[model samples]
Target: MPVAVITGGGAGMGLAVATVLVADGWRVALLDVNSTVGEAAAASLNSNQIKDGSEAQSLFIRTDVTKYDDLRTAFATVADRWGGNIDFVFANAGIAGGTDFYNDSDSEPQQPSLLVEEICLRGVVFTSHLAMHYMRRNKPAPGGVIVSTASAASIYASPELPLYAAAKHGVLGLMRSMSLQLASEGIRVNSILPGAIRTTLHTKTIWDQFPVGDFTPVEEVVSTVLGLVNDPTATGRAMEISAGETFDRKQPDYCNETMQRIMQGKSY
Candidate 1:
């Protein structure tokens, strides 16, 4: 059976992706730091517990993506359980907390601290590295995919959450570079840049602060993720999901022109 591994699988978009994949007949291995939530998520998807029992087989492992050893162990466990073939890996673990640009007097440490870099950027890079290691070892199967959950912040910078924006931009670069590097290996690396998803992580106050009025539903994000998983032709691409809509990453003007010139073997 094809196997998929999802980091940050305990809650939010990660859990939603796991649930959708389980329904689609893919065995899932969930990795997250929150043991309680992770275990509960696994139980929710396990085929054995359901009456119809058609759900995909699932397991949970406590992991901290910031730690390489933890990610290594989690991948090993998944490999052992699923016979060494990882069909898909979703590096979706992330965190969001920072200082408010509008409020300089808001001396709360929760606002724009170093934690954003530690968890969001550094953690994502570590997670992607581990995923790449495992993906490189996997025997090529149809639809072999590696995806990371980035944010719309990658394209449109947000001054209020500068660190978060930088981290997500780094994620986009990671995906693009990995896509080029792994193409010959039959492993496709991509990213899903979600606009605004309603999850425990995003408070109502935050949404109100955003230029966009509300958070997009989790279901909409999950559907876009599933679509990427199902589409073999989508490689080195970033798919954006937001309130009932989905779009591809827009190429920069310079890059597009450069690509056109390169294709025609002529200077722009």
Candidate 2:
């Protein structure tokens, strides 16, 4: 059976993804900071194993992605549990950041919290770096797949949420760079940029503010994720999923001195 490691698997889209993967005959390792929710989610998934008869199981590992050591331990545990091969990784943990730059607050605007940067941007990088180590060893599985949860902010600027946008932009850059760097190793990296999904990430006030039918369902994002996981040719692609439509963002080619030097086989 294929093995998957998903960050932020305790709730929302993470749990939804884990449930689907378990039902589809994949053993999953869920990493979440909230041990209670993580364990409960795993139990819920396992409760259905009798119905699926796939004997699929889930392991919940309490992890704070902002900490590198936590990520290393989670990945190692997954590798050991699954016999040293990880078929897939989903780097999906993130926050919306501190107050938006343009929020309607009476208080003066403050800079984005360092915690937001650490979790949203640095956490994704650390997860991807760890994923490469295991994914490279996943032989006989046509290489391993990595899918990250970016956001629509990755492509378009959000003046209201400047730091959130910046963090997502960082995710895109990491995904694109690693996708090209790891292609030869058969490890494909891609990202999903979903628009306003009705997950725990949104508060009730945020949800109520949205027009009816404006927010994309969590299931829609889950379906897109499944598609990306199964598509062998997908790499370095950022898929934008909105309420009524979905599309891939076009990435530009690099043609700078760095590219020229790399093409000439010059070491950096």
Candidate 3:
């Protein structure tokens, strides 16, 4: 049986991805700090298994991705349980750094600006490093994959969430570098840049601050993720998932032109 490890699999987009993967015949290991919700979500996926008529092997481990030791232990447990190989890894654990814009003087000092950096940027980096360590040791079962949940903020700068944008940009940089490094191992690493997804993480308080109702369904994002996992040729790619639209992350022509002009010392 193929095994998949999903961080932040307790709720929202993480849970959605776990459910879909389990239904498609993969055993799931859910890693998250929220023990209560994580266990519940794992149990829910086990209960929903069909066709196989047997429950999916699901384990919920309490993990803090910001800590390297915690992530090391979590991966060890999964490797031991599944015989030292993982078919896929979803570094989907992330938090939204609320509406702490630079212009907001009334906002508290301990807002999304610093918090997003710790959780999204540092956390993803630590988790992906551990994932790569384990992945390099295992033999690929036809198709080995690593997918992460980046955001549209990676490309577009959002002044309202400067830190969040910066952190996601870091995720892109991580993916780009890892893709080249991991190619020889046949372990594909990619990211899903979801524009907006209707998940619990987007709470009313958060929505009130940003006030954007447009959201792509969780199913759509999950489908895109699955496609990347199934495609052996896809590596170092980012799939953008938005409502009624999708695209691969590609460099724009203007950026290339601007770079050439800069190299030629041309004025704007």
Candidate 4:
């Protein structure tokens, strides 16, 4: 069976992906900060509870992705338990928080919170770094796929959550920068930018505010992720899944022939 590791696997899209993979005979480790949801999710995915002595088809490990030690240990445990080869990694752990930075009403200059970036951007970097290491341990060949959960904010503006938008943009940039290089090592890197989907991240009242076509279905996100994972030729791709449709957002074209030649150092 193929082995996979998923961050934020306790709920939402991560758990959904785990469910699909398990049904298809993939062994998975669910890493999440929430022990209760993580344990329950693992148990539910397994036919028999994976006691320490038994072969674990699905395992849950409490991990705070922002902490390197936590991420490193979680990946190591999965590699050690699953025959030392990791086939896929989903750096899907993220959180949403924003503050009004321009506010002048504060009596004191309060420290701005960067928790969103810490979890979304930094976490993905940490997870993918470890992913490459263990995936290179594959016995016969070194190969794996990595996908990070970016957001619609990655490409467009989210005036409501500027910090979150910036963090997601970093995720997109990180994927694009690494994908081309990792392809040489038999690894594929990609990012999934999802529009609003009703999940545990926020209440229904908040999500409901989106107009009709603005809210996307979680099922679409799942399919987009699996499509990228299975497509051998896909790398350095940004898949935007929203409102039951998929689109590829390629890098913008050069401004002009002269600039293109100058920047690319080659003919247009």
Order by lDDT, highest first: 4, 2, 3, 1
Point out where model 4 deviates above 4 Å.
48-56, 211-213, 256-268
In angstroms, how far off is 144's CA in candidate 2? 0.3
lDDT of residue 249 for candidate 1: 82
Q: Count the backbone clashes (under 3 Å) in each candidate.
A: 4, 0, 0, 0
Q: Write the number of the candidate with greater lDDT, choosing between 2 and 3.
A: 2
Lowest lDDT 10-residue stretch of candidate 3: 104-113
Residues 30-97 of candidate 1 have per-residue lDDT tens digits of: 99999999999998788443234664599999998888789889989998988888888888888876
Model 4 worst lDDT run, 10 consecutive residues: 47-56
Which pairs clash in model 1? 98-111, 98-112, 99-111, 99-112
Which residue runs of candidate 1 sit more than 4 Å off their true CA positions?
47-55, 100-112, 140-143, 204-213, 255-268
In the order shown, what is each candidate's alpha-carbon RMSD?
4.3, 3.3, 4.8, 3.4
Q: Model 4, 193: alpha-carbon shift in Å?
A: 0.6
Per-residue CA lDDT of candidate 4, range 1-268, in tens?
Answer: 7898999999999999998888777899999999999999999898643334344499999999999999999988988887899999999999885466555664887767778889999999999999989877787899899999999899999998888999999999899878867889999999999988878877777877888688788888888899999999989889998888898999788787897677545664
Identify the candidate with maximal TM-score.
Answer: 4
Maximum-lDDT candidate: 4
Please give, for residues 2-22, the per-residue lDDT of candidate 2 as tens digits. 899999999988899988999
Q: Can you give the lDDT of residue 25 in candidate 4?
A: 75
Which of 1 and 3 is the better model by TM-score? 3
How much is 120 displaced in model 4, in angstroms?
0.7
Residue-level lDDT for 124 in candidate 4: 95
